[model samples]
Structure formats: C-alpha cells, structure tokens
Target: MAKTIHIALVGNPNSGKSSLFNVLTGLNQKVGNFPGVTVDKKVGSCQLADGLNATIIDLPGTYSLYPRREDEWVAYRVLMQQDKEVVEPEMVVLIADASNLKRNLLFASQIIDLKIPVVVGLTMMDIARHKGIQIDVAELERELGVPVIPINPRKNKGIQPLKKAIEQTALELYKAPVRDFINNEALAPAAIGSVKELFPELSDYKAIHYLINHESFALHGHLQEKIESIEQVNNFNHTKTQAEEILQRYQRIGSILKQSVSEPSPLKKTLFTEKLDNIFLHRRWGYIILLAVLFLLFQSVFWLAEYPMNIIDWGFGEISSWLGNVLPSGWFADLLINGIWAGLGGILVFIPQIMILFGLVTILEDTGYMARISFLTDKLMRKVGLNGKSVMPMISGFACAVPAIMSARNIENKKERLLTILVTPLMSCSARLPVYTILIGLVIPKTMFAGFLGLQGLVMMGLYLLGPIMSMFVSYIARFFINIKEKSFFILELPVYRAPRWKNVLITMVNKAKIFVFDAGKVIMVISLILWALSTYGPKEKMRSVAARYEQQIKQHPEQEAELNRLKNTELLQNSYAGLLGRSIEPVIQPLGYDWKIGIALITSFAAREVFVGTMATLYSVEGGDDADENTLMEKMNAAVRPDGTKVYSLATGISLMIFYAFAMQCMSTLAIVKRETRTWKWALIQLVYMTGLAYIMSLIAYQLLK
Candidate 1:
C-alpha cells in the first residue's frame, strides 16, 4: 500500500496561491465549510506516480503567522494543529510572486520555522523575465534548504515538478537539513539571543512567539516544550521582550535577502504595470470609465436577455396551455397548469438577467480590474465611513446580496464589515430587475430622450443608481453610532492583468445560476402553490350563495348573461380565502393605492421578489374565463379599478411599488447570508426592520406625493 501525502499550500494574498490550487486540482476540488465555522475549506486530490495520491488543502491567504481577521485565524489554527485529523501537513508548498519576492518572503520565513518539509513555488517567472528580473533558482533553493520551482500556474507550467517534489518528501526519499543551510549564522544567533534576554522566564518558542508578536503561538504545546529548552540555556536573562525578538528576526531576514539577491539596476522600469494603472486608477477618468462599464452591464442585462427570456416565457406558457387542453378537467390538471407551471415560469424568466450579471462580475474579477476599482474608490469610500475594501461587496450586491455579504468576510474591521453587509441588500439585486422592468414598462412613456436616453432607459438607470446613493447615506448614519478604534487601511496588490479565463468564468456563471434557480426557486414554487390553492378554493357555502344570486340576475336580464357571469367570477374571487387574506391586509396598504389582489401579491412576494408575477398569474387564472389569453395578464392588471372607480395600478402605485422593491429585504437567501456573515442575529434583524420601514415610508410618500 502506498502512503497518502497531505500537502498544504500557503502564500500571501495575490501570490497565485488560489490560481495554483485551481491548476493542480482542476475539477477535483471540493468546497465546504470548515468543521465548526462558516469559513471555506477547499481540498482536492491529485494522483501521483506509482499509485500514490496526495491530498492538497489550500489554506486561506495570510500575511504572517500573526492573524487579525477571521479567515486568517482559521489559517493559523489549521497550521498550528498537530493532530493527524487536524493540522498535520507532510509538506508545505509556499507560493511566492517572482515579481515581488521581498514582500512574499515574510510569510515564507515563518513557515520555514515550523520544521515541516517546505518547497517554494515561485510564480510569475515569465512576467519577471519580461520585466528584466533574473533569479538564480538553484542558489535560492540551496540557500533556503528547500526546492524552488519557477512556474506560472496560469500557464500550466511546472506543476508536474511541484507534484514530484511533494511525492519525494511524502515518501521520505528527500531529507534536507533544516538550519544548517543558513549562511548568516551571526544574525540568527544574535536574534535568538535577543529573544532569550527579553523574556528569560518564557520558553524559547514563547520568546520566538513574543518576537513575532504571534500571541496565538503560545497555544501550541510542542512550541511550549521547545521554548522551555531554550529558557534553560545558561546566562539567559528576562530583559528583552518577545516583540523586540521578533523585530530582530525580520531584521535578519532583510539582511539575508540583501546578501543573496542582487539587482542589475536598483530601479528598473515597470512600464507595463504602471502604464495600465495610470489610466485605470485616474481620479476623474476612472470613475467615468467605471460608470460606462456599469451602464454597459445594465444594458446587456436588458437588451441581450430579451430573446432568451421570451423563449422561456413562450415555452412555459405553451406547455401550460397544451397541458390544460390535453388533460382532463380535474384537481390534478388545475394543480399542474395553474400552480406548478406558473411557479416554474416565474423562475425561468429571471435566468437571463442572472447569467448576464454573473458573467460580467466574473470577467471583472478575473481580469483584476475589480481590485483597481476598489483602489480608485477607496478615498471616497472612507469619506463616507466605509473602507475601500467594502466596494467589492457593494458592487456584488447588484448581482445578488447573499454572496455579496459572504464576500465581506475578507474585510477585517468589524464595524465597517457589518455596515457594508447591512447596506448591501439595499443595492437592488438582480432579482429586483424583473419587477422594475415590468412596472416601468407598464407606467413609463415610450418616448426616447434625445434618441439615446429613452424614458424606460432613464428610469432603469435611476432605479439602479438609487440603491448606492441610499446605501451611502445609510452607512454614514450608521457610522455615527458605531465606534471604531482600529486602524483601517486599504492596501491591495494589483495583480498583473491577464486575459479573462473563459472556462473559469463560465463554470462560475453556471454554478451561480443553478444555485439561484434551485435554492430560491424551491421556496418560490412552494409559496406559489399554496397561494394558488388559497385563491382557487373559497368558502363553499359563500361561493354557492354568490353564484346563485348571479344566476338569478342572469335570468332577470337574459341578454346580459355573459357579463353577469364575469361579475360572478370576480365576486367569488373577492370572497375566496386568498381574497379574504388580502382584504384583511388592505387597510395597511390602501394608502399606497393597492387593491386586495395586489395586496396578496405584495404579501407573497416578501418570500422573493420574483414570486410577485407568478402570484399574480395564479390569482388571475382562478378568476378568468376558459378563453383567457396569457398576454392579457398585463392588460387585466392595467384595467383593474377600485370600488370607487379609480385605477388601482395608477402611475403613483407603479412608482411606489418600484421604490418599495428598490430598498426592501425581499430575499430570504440574503437574510440567511447576513446571519452567516455577521455571526449574530442582531445585525440581520436590524437590517430587516430598518430596510422594511424605510421602504414602507418612502413608498407611502412617493404614492401620496404623486397622487
């Protein structure tokens, strides 16, 4: 039986750690939450030579052993564990960026001290060569006492060699001496001595911990034993502290880099990165460019999705119509055509918008322009009480708020992170687009503005822009109450730009779209079915009495029998269970110009915004005659009038409905994600209460003012 190797891949942020893992694992990766936390744990297996298999765990990116964030803490905890099931890594592959070796080496040196078999996966070698950077890999390997392989993970180079190295270390065929390879003994000894003198009462490992400022390092029992041995050394004094000792170690590493690394020219031109950044990060032009990009994104969602959306709509409608004509008229037939078919159609209509949004986001993120957007917006964001890092999550809200909140886990500041998560859902997720599109089309005039900015287009832009402005205002108010003492800085590495990886982007789009349709769709379907049932059956005695009264009127005015029958169906619907429920809630919503039927749709839509259309479909199907045309749903809605002979879906009501959805917490998935990200019910509850209240008040004002 061949031995199984456990390899951990570690590196600083933007050092190609994830890219390398993706390259090695490909489709073999599995993503799940770590044992007790919501943080992601990615593991994959690769087949090695001679029937051997290596399991690779891609640890979360971190700067040093010292952790200041939740995800980084997970990395620290996993690496510090000694148990086989927990923290045992047979070999650690440290990824370093060839273009920025100095900064990448900080984390590398800390891993070297762990006494694990280590290898250096030096990425971006091709880019380094293009920029005239030369590195002697053999010298670097010899100096560090570890194998250093120069490869580009993106280009699929040097992965085989990396795998072979892991196998060699796993089988114990490769044994390299640990400390003997360092040529700078003088600096190492002095640094060790400094740690001993600082805290003589502490063990050597504890001293190292103090020197490194890694307070969590004391939790490891093996490190404590090593610290005790160093404490027993002769003439050790409790003088210098751990902080001082760690500073000296960094000083020593700097010295080693100076000795082993040489630059042909002290300052070579990095024209490529600089030239690109110059335009993308420009203060004024950058914002304009970003706005243009966003406009294109929205345009694509509306224009490009029309064909597919129409196809889905027609397909579902035809299927339901065919089933109704073919199947016997019974309870099961009604359930299939009116309940399940309508629910599924509602879900299918939103697919085009979701796919387009996901694809745009993936392309932006993969090409590294998303980070630049953050950098460009950092100063403005900070002025509004949000860190620039929060911009990514805010932008992600446009696609969907659930994953947007999940992405905020990367933000270290607690208050800023919380605020970002709270305001993100207000940024009009793609789900809201369907509601907006329907309402705007019904209400807004069809005239073009200067032949470019049409009435519908301008209204769409206003709806999309309203969320961010409201978010900023809400964040500013929230900041006044939440006190933050920690230092907040936005320092992100701008990865070298590359062509967008279509395969990765496509896979991501498919996965996101599938999850959205299935996860949220199930709830929508169930609610739609229950709503359909509620609207279909009324109090039997009441319906019979109403029908009998209408039949008497039909006989009295035999020439008006068809009109009487239509009025009877409407009366039966008004008295149905769904109708009574809607009437019960009508007092609360009447001020906003909604009737009982619209009330029912509004209430059911709180489960999901997209359910509104399906709910309306079910409501109409129960009342309309056998010759009801699918295209007449909107016309019926438009022609609906209140008991007082006033229009129900007037311009005021349509605008108010659009405003309500623009700010409401209508997605349960987003709420669940808020709970996960904030790790408390307090913020999520606050988000629900405040956002709903705001929506109600704003919509009321819009309706009253317009009316």
Candidate 2:
C-alpha cells in the first residue's frame, strides 16, 4: 500500500486560503482541534493519482514566521517541526495573494528559505489585473526558483495544474531551488553555525528561529538552557536580527519583482475597489448603509424563509395527525408522537430561518464587508475598552458563541480579548433564533410599513441589535473592574470587495443547519423526552387519584366527556412531577409573566436555548393529547390561556420572555467553551451568574411596565 502524503497549506489572511481548501476538499473535510490546543485543525484528503492519496492540513494564516498570537504560534510550530503532536508535512502549498504581492511575498520568501519543498499558488489574479498590475508567471517562477501556479479558487480555475505542481514537488520530480530566498546563514554566522551544529537536521532559517523562540519552543530544559547560554554569550539581539532579516528579504524581493512584475504608478491608479469603498466606507454614509444592510439581512431571513418554514410546520403537523390515526393508542405510541416527534419537529421547523441567517452572514463575509464593519465600529468599540478586532468575534457570536469565543484568540491585547470573550455571549446567537422567531410571531404584527419594513423582522433585528448594545454597556462597566491596563491598537487590512460566492453561501447554510440539528438537536431531544415522562406521570397515588376522579366525572356526564377529559389532563399535568418542578419555580418567575409551563421551559432550556421550543412542544403535546390532530407548536402555543382565560402569550408576556432569553446565558456548551478558553471556572461561573441575573432583572422590569 502507498503511504498517504502529508501536505500543509499555508497562507496570509484573506489570500483565498479557505476558498481553495473548500474547492480542493469539497465535502471530504473534517474540523478538529490541534493536539494540546483549541485552535481548529481543518484536514481533508484528495486523490492526487490512482495510487496516491494526500492528506491536506490547512494551517492558520499568518503574516510572518515570527509568532505572537496563539494561532500564529500553532502555524509557526507546525511549519518549524517543533510541535511533536502534529505529523510533519513532507511538502507545503504556499498561497500568495497576487494583488498584495509585496506583503504576501514576505511570508512566502520565509517559507521557501525553511528548506521545505513548496509550490506557490498565486490567487486574486483578477483583482491584481483590475488594479493594473501585470505579472510574468514564468519569469516569476524562474526568479523564485519554484513552480508558480496562478489559481482563481472562486472560479475553480488553475486547480488541476496547481495539483499537478504539488504532486511533482512532493514526488521530488520538480527541480529544486538552487539557493535560498535570502542569505540566512550570513545574518548571525556564529550563532547560526552553533545552532545548526546542535541540530544537524535544521535549516539555517530554522536554526535562527530556535535562537529567537527557544523559550516558546518545546525543547528540553537542557537544550533551552544551552540556547539561552548561546544567546547571552553571542549578545544576540532577537529584535535586531528579525529587523535585519526582514529588510534583507524585502530588498531581495524588490530586486526580484523588478524583473518579473509591473504595475501602474500608485499616483495614477484608482482601482474599482477604491471607487466602491468611497460609498461603503464613507464616514457619514457608511453607518447608514450598514444599518440598511443589516435591516435587509434580518428582513430577508423572514421573507425568504416564510414558505419553507410554513411547509415544515405543516408537514410535521400532518405527520403527527397521521400517526395519531395510524398508530395503536398506547404509552409507546404516545411517546413516539409527543416525546420524540414533537422534539424533532420543534427543532427542525426552524431550519429555514437558521439557513437564511447563516447564508446572509456568509455573504457579508465573502463580500469583504465584514472587515469594513470592524473598521467602522473600532471607534465605538474602543470607547467600551475594546477595538476593531473585538467586532469580528462579537459578530461571529450571532452564529454561535463557542467558535466566537475561540476566535477571540486573535486579539493581541490580553485584556481586550478577555473583555471580548466575557460579553460575547450576550450577542444573541442562532440558538436564540427559534425562541425569537416563535415569540415575535406570537406577539409582533406581521404587517409591513409601506409594504417593505416588516414589524416582525424589525422586532427580530431589535433583538439582534440589543445584544451588542448591552454588550457594549457591560464591557464599559467591566473594564474598570478588570484591573489590567494595556495600550489598545486597531490595525486592519481591508480586503478588496468582491461578489459573494454562492457555493460557499449554500455550503454555510447547510452546515449551520446540520450543526443545529445534530448538536443542539441532541440536547433538545433528550430534554423533550425527559419532560414528556415527567409531565405524563407523577407521584403514583396522585396520578391514580386524578385518573379515577376523571373517570368518575366522565361516567356522571357523558355529554361533557370531552371537556372533562381536557380538564383531567390539565389537572393531572399540574400534579405530575414535571408540573411540580415547574410550579416550584413559578412563584419566582411569575413577575416575568412566565407561568408553570414557561417555567418548565426555562429549566430545561438551561441545557440550550433552542431546547425551549422543543420543551414547550413536548409539554403542550402531553397536556393537549390528541384533541387537535393537525396542531403545530405555534398553534398550540397561540391558543394557550392562563387561569383567568387571558391569552398566555399576550404582547407583554411575549416581550418579557423574549427579553429573558435575550439576556440569559442558558447554553452549557457556551459555558464549557468559556471555561476552556479562559482556563478557569471562575469566569465561566461569573458569566452565568451575571448574565442570568441581568436577564431576571430586565425581564421583571419589562413585564411590569408592559403589564
């Protein structure tokens, strides 16, 4: 059997790295964490030949080999062969942005000098051409001493040749570079020679890295001490050496580019991207455009998803009715319909909204407006003790907080990163989407203003916006107490705007829906079943007494048997174990306009916010029984009433409940991720207490005022 060839994909940020990865791997990819770190490891396998299968590891993007952030450290370790846990790649595919050649080549040149066999895949050629930049690919290849393949990952162009180049390079059939990109050995001759002597396998470039980053490397204590001693004896200045190395490499790059590349003079060039940025990034109009964009996004979620969401709701309701008639009437049948099916339906019906929401967010990111959003919000963020970098994580929080918190690792300032993590959960995630949709549908009118602005969508947007607003307020107050002072900087590279990739958008929608189904779905299903059982059976004597009394009542008045049966179910549920648990908390939550049923949802939803919908579906299903054959969760919830015969989901009650879910830190997964990211349970517990407490107080005030 042929051994699987290992290859690493390295690139600078926004150099089409992810796009190329998606094109190469398609659906044959899996995400996992690198050993001993929470950084995401994206690995995929592709058939390079009939007998040759290659595994590709997509490393985090970095501007240079020098590591600062955790992600950069991970990339540096993998490339330098310092991480023992990872398999060292036999070859590397270095992605470089053609439009940003000068900056991109800095990292590319460093990789080439590491002595790793590499193929350069140049991306964004169209963008480069739009900017009036011309490149001689053959001449550039000859200059760099490596085969260069210009690839447009968006259009799936140049992939076959790129793959072939990678194959040839990995097989060592391609001619190797005759010399290094720069004279690495001449930087510090004595220290480089000494380090290389200690480790014969290391290249001149790798040896220098060890001298500079030995403290961070996984070297043995004695080796670390030896390197420190060498450093002290040679008076090696890591900073000066790094500066010199960069200067020399760039100087060589300038000489190389002079022969192989050309561009319009900077004074004469006004690219299409600049023309568009004039409007999108305008000081005054930018904020207005951003709001308009977000408004459209939220409105589109409802408008486009209306039909599919309704179809899903109707399909589930019909299936329930069909099962009610077809299945044998028994506890098993009841469990299947009300316990499992109800949970599944509750979770699945929101798939359209989830897909649309994610799809829109993906478009914003693909179009490169996401970076602009960060730039636009930097001023506002810094006022609250954060900077532009915090906006990405907070925006990502809308999709999910688990990954959002992890993304905070990119923020260089420790205090800012911590602050970003602490309040990010407050940004309403998609888990809260189901809760928001159902409540907004319950209370907010679907009427449109001037046939465009939907009240329901407006409410949804408000819920989404409320999260960041509250997060800012919390961050401002928390900064004073954090007690860590550091100068904050916000430096961002705005990518040239381009059209959204539809394939990527579709994939994002599907993946997000799957995550919701399989990940959050598990929690919802379990909670639904447990809730079903608890709502169905109580203390044995109380259950028996309730059943017997109902039977006696039915015998006395057969004409009222339907009403009597309904009453019995309601009373029996009130006496059941689930009802008892809910009632215990009802007193505390009543001020928030939540009764025992909503109380039960609150308790079960602590596992996950989306589980509230499933819990309510299960509870109401058990309580309502087979009285309504084709009743969807929304219908059941809509018809529910309090003891005074008032609608349970009145405007005030719905608003309060929405507010509660808006502020509550109800996800255990989020809590666990916080703990992992912070490496302590203290922050996690604090997050839970403060968020839940704020939810309670805010919910109480909203309910009282509205009532």
Q: How many clashes show up in model 1?
A: 9
Strongest candidate by TM-score: 2
Return the TM-score for each candidate structure.
0.82, 0.84
Candidate 2 C-alpha lDDT tens digits along 1-707: 76589989999999999888888888777765677665768888888876778899999998999976667888999999888878999998999999989999999899988888889999999988887899999999988888899999999999999989987886788755658789888988899888877899888888899999888888889989888888888899999999999999999999988998998888976777788899989999998998787667656766787789778878988999999999999899889998899778867766786677677777988998978887888898999999887886787677667656766765777789889999999989878988998798888888999889999989898998899999999999999988776666576788888899998788667765765566556756776688678867889999899999999989999999877877787678778887798899999999899989998788768756987876776656533224243246778888999999999998999999999999999976677668766767799899999999999999999989998
Residue 111 displacement in candidate 1 (angstroms)? 0.3
By lDDT, the best candidate is 2
Q: Write the per-residue lDDT of candidate 1 for residues 1-707, one digit (tens) a residue.
A: 86668888899987888888877777677665565454667888778778788789988888877777666777776666522345477788899988777777767766766556788899978777777767878877776777788878777889899888877777776654446322322333555665566446443343444444433443466555544555555333334443454565667666766665555585777657678888878878888998787667656756777788779978997888899899998879989887898877866676776676677767887788878877777788887789878887787677667656766766776778878988999888767877887688678889977778798888898998999999999999998887766667676778878777776676556655665576557766776688678877889999889989999999899998766776776677778887788889889888877777878777667656876775665555433223344346667777778788988778999999999889888766676557655556687789999998988899999999998
RMSD per candidate (Å) reads: 5.6, 4.8
Candidate 2 Cα outliers beyond 4 Å, as residue runs:
1-3, 36-38, 175-178, 323-335, 389-466, 480-489, 590-598, 604-662, 666-685, 700-707
lDDT of 1: 0.74
Model 1, which residues run further than 4 Å from truth? 35-38, 82-87, 180-207, 210-246, 258-260, 301-356, 406-410, 437-457, 480-487, 510-578, 614-635, 675-682
